[model samples]
Target: MNLIEQLKTILSEEQVTTNDVILEQHSHDESYHTPHLPDVVVFPNTTEEVSKVLQFANDNKIPVVPFGLGSSLEGHVVPEYGGISLDMSQMNQVLEIRNQDFLVRVQPGVTRTQVNKELNKHGLFFSVDPGADATLGGMAATNASGTTSVRYGIMRDQVRDLEVVLADGTVIHTGGLSAKSSSGLHLNGLMVGSEGTLGIITELTLRVFGIPEKITAARATFPTIQNAVDAVVAVMSAGIPMARIELVDTRSIQQVNTSLETTFEEAPTLFLEFHGSEAALQYDVAFTQDILKDYNCMNFAFEQDSKARNALWELRHNLAYSFIHSAPGKKLMVTDASVPINELPSAILHSRAKIEEMNLDAAIVGHVGDGNYHVLMMIDLSNPYEIEQAKILNEHIVNFALSKGGTCTGEHGVGIGKAKYQALEHGAAYEVMKSIKKTLDPNNILNPGKIFRDINE
Candidate 1:
């Protein structure tokens, strides 16, 4: 039987859509890549339904693309090969919230904001925030990290267990609530950041932290990027336990100031947040300010008022949107590269020089406390030379990071855009990845043309 016929029999007509409108919607993600329409879009409401869909697709050698909120900056869910786009929106139900255990079980389609809203009622919250209100599944798929990552690590660290549907529709539980494990191969590690190539995450058990009693946010400005990075390095080395430490270059600051309609010094700025008791928070800020003195901090300001602090972080969180607002019609090609903690300053300095030499209008910003940063370049997609310049710059940056024992991507996974650098970054590990991919997806139907391309082709 044909793939469409099999799908029709197993799922309701509304669950499967061949409509151009739905296909078009699922074709693209938040990236620079052109959209490719999927042959069909399926909304599976249950884990069993998803497994059934995957099983049929696997049996028929059909490509299956697991989709979350489509917030991925990389083209991980673009449906490039034109197969089944498995939409998980309908499955967005909070399955369970174990308050005593400080864990929550959620369906793949639930958004981070939604999780937070619900968890707020219980006085518990998930710490991983990528600033996009991205789905937990997509965050896990990308192993995403953001400002808070400096204190609470990334999505991978928060995941306690995953109910992943394998390529062959086998449902497997990777890990449980217990912290450490000395078992066999880490299926959880394999599934997280696999970019939907390994399997589809149906349900996730995530760690939740108690909402801090007091939150103090501050903004510090420096004359140079080096000073900003140096201050962050000092803070980290001092073990201050900052909840958020983000670096925004001068160019990005201008963009945010214009977009946010707020006056900020057009210099490298660091937004920081500390979470603790009232007294401890005060002491932390004082100590942080003292440390910043050595870096020649141009300005240091803190917000104790809830409303003002929210406004401050709102600007920092939405700084990426400032790039959009500044460029009006231009699309951004962002690079999330990370180097060793000590090497971050040099790495960012190198990137700044390359951008100037290339004469590209780009902004550098990131959760720099983790040695991870993104170069958000506003590219005129119509200009061939400009696109070529971006590719060259991206290659140069990736090569630089790889040479310094850094990763091609610190947060963004190797979707189609960064897949080319996989071999160089992974080497023999790349072959091992391919072997695993082949073992799990022999037909190469799950997210085809992603992570690894056809060797001969």
Candidate 2:
């Protein structure tokens, strides 16, 4: 039987589809990388189904690309080899909520928002919010984190265990429900950020957190990027418990105000959040304000009410969408990099200088507390000059971060976009990674063309 006929035999005809619309949707993620449609898309409803599909593909030597919500910033979900795009959306379910243990076991298709909605009913919440309402499985695959990562940590920290399917369709469980263990290999960590090259995640046992007693938000505008970054360093040095610390450049602030019609100052600004008792929040705010004053802080707006605090974060979170809204037809060429905390000021400075030199239309924003940031630009894909300029600016920013002994990618995984930097950033360690990949996936049928590149091993 042909591949489509075999898929239909394994699953109902309605579950396995060759429709062009669905194929196009699974072709690429949110990245600007070129898209290629998969030959077939299969919706798997359980771990057994996923295993059977993998076993079949392993036997036939067909590539298998797992699909989530298609919200990734990198081209992590793009099917470059045009095989089966295993759509995991059919497996969405919150299997168990161990409220007393502060943990939850969910299917790979469960989204961050959906888990939070369930957790909220028990007066608990998930800590890692990557801005997009992405699936928890996708977040684990990329080891993603965002605003809350400055406090609660990234996806790797949240994953207590995972139910994974091996390349040969063998099912295995990694880790357990305990808080910590010294039993054996840390397979959970290894699989969390593998980008589907190592194994496919079937179910995730994640740790959740209780809602804070009091949550407050604030905006601090600075005269320059250096001042804003220095202020962030001060907060960390002082050991202030910050929930989040984000930076938006003056141009980005202007774009936000223009797109959202808010009256925020068009200056280098910091959007901060604090989670603690009301009194503690006030004390931290006062101490943070004092530090900012030394750095020429132009404005400080303290938001204590929940509505106002949400509005402040909404403004910061919507900055990228603002650029998209203002320019209807242009493609967004977004890229991200990370650096050590002390090196953040220089990194942003170098990036700004290059952006100004290239005269590219762009905005700068970041999770400044963690020394991670992004460059948001609307590009014309048809213009080779524009594409080349974007690549140059991205490389310049990545090089600056790498020179500081940091990574080419911080939160976003090394998809096709950042695959070329693996050898440059990792050196000999990159080879070890390739060896591991080739060992786990001998046929290289799982998510081909990711992380490592140009390997003939």
Candidate 3:
């Protein structure tokens, strides 16, 4: 039987397709990276089906790239070497909610928003909000973090256990349900950020948090980008427990105001959120206000109304879309670089300078609380000059961050876009990663050309 026929036997015929539209949909993610279509797309509805598919692919030496919602900023889901695009959406289900254990067991296809909706009923919530309603499997693969990462930690921290299917069809549990462990080699850490290079994630067990008694959101405007970033440093140094602290530069604020039709101050601003008891939030807000004054904070506004608070975050989360909307017929190339807390001010300033020097249409924004920032650049993909300039700016920003002991990618995984920097960022550790990849996937049939340029290389 042919590949499609063979896959149909594992899944229902309706679950396999080679339609042009379906292939196009699975070809790329929300990234500027070049896309490639898989020869066939397969939707596995269960862990056993996934295992069978992998077992067949391993024996035949065919590449299998897992697909989520395709909301990834990097080209993590692109089928660089066409074979099988494993769509996990069919398996999406909130399998179990261990409310007493503060954990939720879910299939790989469940989205963060979907999980939260179910968790809300139990007065619990998942904290890793990566702006997009990304699938839990994809989030775990990339080790994604967002505004809340400053306090709650990243995706890896929330993952209690993972039911993964290896390249050769062997199933393994990376970690157990215990709160902590020193039992083995820490496979959970290895698989969480592996980006589908080592294995395919079939299911996940994640830690969840109870709804806070009170949640307050505030925005603080600053005279300059440096001042705003400095204020972030001050607030973090003060040990204020902030649920979210995001920085939006003047250009980005302008875009937000223009797009959302809201009269926000056109200055470098910090969007802050605090979660705690009503009395505790009041004290933290007061203390945070006092500290903001030291950094020339122009205006400090408290968004007490829940509707207004949601609007505020909506504006922040939609900042990227605003840039995209403003620039028609252009693609966005975002640079994700994270630096040490103390180096954030200079790092952001340097990025702003580079953007100006290149005269590119870009904006500065970040989850500044954790020293990670992104430069959103809109470039004409068809124009070679524009693409080259964007690439140069990305290299400059990444090199600067590396110099300061930061990472080329803070939350976005090392997909094709950031693969070139793997050796530079990890050094001798890069070799160790390649060894692990080879050991797990000898045929290099799983998500080829990711993490490293090629497993052999």
Candidate 4:
């Protein structure tokens, strides 16, 4: 039988498709990276089905790229050397909710928003929100982090265990339900950020948090980007337990105001959130305000009303879309980098300078609390000159962060876009990673051309 026919036997015929529209949908993610269509797409509904599909693919030496919602900023799901695009959406289910243990078990296809909606019934939430309603499995695959990551930790921290299917169809559990362990090698950490290169995650057990008694959101504007970033350093230095601290530069705010029709101050702004008891939140807000005063804060206000607080975050979360909306017929190349808190100011300033020097239209925004920032650069993909300039600016920003002992990508995984930097970023460690990849996937039939490029290329 042919590939499509063979896959249909593993899944129902309705679950396998070669429709042009479906192929197009699976070809790319929300990235500027080039896309390639898979020869066929398969939707497996159970762990056994996934195992069977992988067994067949491994025996035949066919590449299989597991796909989620395709909301990734990098081209993590592009199916570069496509044979099968394994769509996990059909398996999405909240299998179990362990409220007493603050844990949840879910299939690989569950999304962050979907998980939170179910968790909210028990006064719990999944905190590693990466701007998109990304699938929990994809979030784990990328080790994604967002605004809350500064306080709650990243995706790897929340993952308690994973039910993974290896390239050769062997099933393994990377961790357990215990709060901590030293039993064996740390496979959970390895698989969480492997980007589907080593294996496919069939299910996940994640840690969740109870809803706080009180929540407060605040916004502060500064005279300049330097002052706003300095204020972030000050707030972190004070050891204030901030749930979220995001920085939006003046250009980004302008785009937001223009796109959303809100009258936010056109200055560098810090969006802050705190979660705790009412008294504790009040004290933290007051203390944070006092620290901002020393950094030339122009305006500081606490959003007390729930609607207003939500609205404030809505604007911040939609900043990237605003930039996209403003620039018609252009693609976005977002550069992610992280430095130590002390080096954040220089890193951000250097990024802003490079953007200006290249004469490109870009904006600086980030989850500044954890020293990670992104430059949203709009580019005309068809224009070679524009693409080259964007690349140059990105290299400058990444090189600067690397010099300061930061990462090429803080949250966005090393998909095709950042693959070139893996050797530079990891040095001798890169060779170790290559050995691991080879050992697990000898045929290179799983998400080829991700995290590390072919030596010849």
Candidate 5:
């Protein structure tokens, strides 16, 4: 029997497929990176089954690319090499909810939104939004964070444990369910951002938060991008806890107005959220507004009702899709870079200036509270000049961040998109990472094209 028949023995024949439509869907993520089809796609319902498939793939030297919902922004799920696309969607399940412990154990396929839905009954919620309704496993793989991450933290911070299936099909738990431990290597940290280049995560135990006594959402418009970013820095320095603080540039605001049919001001703005007791939240809002005055905040508005607040954020979240909708037949190229809180002003200003210099149509949006921002640019794939401009712009942003002692990618993990910068960004540590890859996945079959192309390269 061939690999397809062999895989069928491990799973139902219906679970192992070579359907053209499925292969096409699994080929790439929401990235401008080129995609390639896997030879087959296999749906594994359990960790044991995932282990079996990995064992078979490893022994036979077939590449196995672990895939979740494919909501990745950096080509994390793209099958760059022809082999098995290990689809984990069938494994979706909320295994356990330890209410008192403020934790939940879930299959890798469980999405962030799904976890939140389940936790809502217990008055709990997962904080790492990542904008996309992405699988928790995929979010962990990318170490994703979104608006609320300014206070709630990233996927890496929320993961208490991970059940990882190794390249040789050996299953291991990388961490304990306890609150804290220093007993072994920080494997949870190591695995969370591995982007499936290290091993396949079959399950995860994550931390959750109780709903705050009060939640408020607000928008602050600034006279200039520099003023907006500077105001964010001031808010941070004031030591008032902010649940979410996002920067949306004038261009992005324009897109939002067009897409959402709202008549908000087209200027640099901050989407703000405060979570705490009613009294404490009021204090945070007052103090934040006080600081914004020093930086020329143009206008301020807030939403208190849950439905209204959700709608406000929904508009911000859809800005990327709005850009796509406006640009006919154009793909998006997002530049990700993070710098120190103090350097954010210079970084964002320089980015805006550079885009204008290149005469590129782009908008700026970011988790400004974390000193991370993105340049959203539309590209025509058929136009070589447009493609080259995107590459040059991305590299420029990455280089600027590196010069300021920031990361090439703050939340988006280093999949194939950021692989080239790994060596330069990590320097000697990059070699250590390669060594770990060689030691853990000697065959290089676990998402082979990610992190970096090869140790030699």
Candidate 6:
């Protein structure tokens, strides 16, 4: 029997879908890469069902793509090759909350916000807050980080353990709750950012943190992007222990003001947050203001009330949407790259020059704490010239970042868009990755044509 018939025999008909509409919807993610519909889409409610499906696909030499809510910036979920798309949405369940250990166990489909809501009841919270309400599985797959990452670290840091299913449908647990260990191979680290090319994640146990006794947010404005980034570097260098440090260029500030229907200065801005006891947070914010003044900051203000802080951050968090609102019928093209702290000034300036040279409309924003920033370019994809210009500009940006001991992609994984540049960036390390992929997935049926092509073949 064919794979579909065999799968239907094992799972309920309602769980398996061959309908074209569903297939098309499951094909691509929130990326500009071309999409190809999967041959079938299946929603598995349990780990056993997922393993069974994987075993069937392995037997049939069918590719399996693990899909979340399809909010990925890269083409991670696009099923370029016809095969089974494993939708993990139905696996959205919070299995347990270990409040004492400051940890939580959840099915792969649980989202960051969902976990936060549950943890709030215990006066605890998960730190990894990628702006989008992305699934835990998707966040793990991409090693996603966001504004709060400056303080709490990335998604990988929060994950204490993962229940992974191998390409052959064998189950394995990666790590444990021990705070530190010189254990066996670092399987947890390996699985956290594998992008589903290595194994499928079934369950995740993540570390959490106690809610801060006090939290404060600030909005600081600078005359230019350089001043803003310089102040960010100074703050970090001074060991301020900021919970969040984000830079929004003047252009982005203007866009946000228009898009959000609020009036703010049309100058480069910094959104800062501090979390700690009342005494410590007070010292941090006061010192931060002094540091910004050294950089010639024009206007600086902070919000301590939770409601005001939420409104302030809500504006900063939705910077991506500002691009969408600015250009109603355009697709948003984002480039996330990181450079050395000192090199950031030159990098940002060069990008601005490129935008002007190309006569393009774009804005720059970044998690400046880590020297990671994105160039959000609104493009009318229908225009051939505009598409070509974007490609050229993006290529230049990636090359510049690499030249400065930086990566072509910071948060976005190598999902087809950046695949071609892997060899150029990794050199000898690229071959090692290919070898690893081959050892883990000999058939190349899992997320094929990504990261590295089969070199032996």
Put down candidate 2 lDDT per residue, 1-457, tens digits, no spaces: 8999998888889889999999999998988889999999999999999999999999999999998999987898899999999999989999999999999999999999899999999999999988888999999999999999999999999999999998999999999999999999999999998989889999999999999999988888988999999999989888999999999999998898788777888889999999988899889889989988988899998888989888887777777778887887777878899999989889888899899999988888999899999999998888898889889999998988999998898898998989999999999999988898888888998899988656554
Candidate 4's residue-wise lDDT over 61-103, tens digit each? 9999999999888899999888999999988999999999999
Local error of candidate 6 at 108, Å? 0.6
The 0-to-1 C-alpha lDDT of every candidate, in the order given, reads: 0.89, 0.91, 0.93, 0.93, 0.91, 0.88
TM-score of each: 0.97, 0.98, 0.99, 0.99, 0.99, 0.98
lDDT for model 5: 0.91
In model 6, the Cα lDDT at residue 419 comes to 82
For residues 1-457, write the lDDT of model 1, one tens digit per residue.
6666679888998898888898888998889988899999999989999889989988888889988888888899999888899998898999899999999999999999999999999999899988898888999999998879989989889988999998889999999988779988888888899989988999999999999998988899998999999999999999998999999899988887787777888999999999989999888899999999999998998787999998887887787777876777788899889999999999999999999998888889988989999998888899998889998998888999999999999998888888998888889989989999989888887898878875325
**Residue pairs in collision within model 5:** none
Q: Give per-residue CA lDDT, model 5, range 245-305, as digits (tens).
A: 9999999988888877889999999999999998898888998889998999889898999
Q: List the residue pairs that clash in candidate 3.
A: none
Off by over 4 Å in 3: none
Give the alpha carbon lDDT tens digit for every residue of 350-420 in model 6: 99899999898888988878888899888888988888888899899999999999999888888888887
At residue 62, candidate 6 shows an lDDT of 93
RMSD, candidate 2, Å: 1.0
Candidate order by decreasing lDDT: 3, 4, 5, 2, 1, 6
Candidate 4 Cα deviation (angstroms), residue 129: 1.0
Worst 10 contiguous positions by lDDT, candidate 4? 448-457
**How much is the lDDT of residue 228 in candidate 2?**
94
Q: Could you say which candidate leads in lDDT?
A: 3
Give me the overall lDDT of model 3.
0.93
Model 2 lDDT, full chain set: 0.91
Clash pairs detected, candidate 4: none
Clash pairs of candidate 6?
none
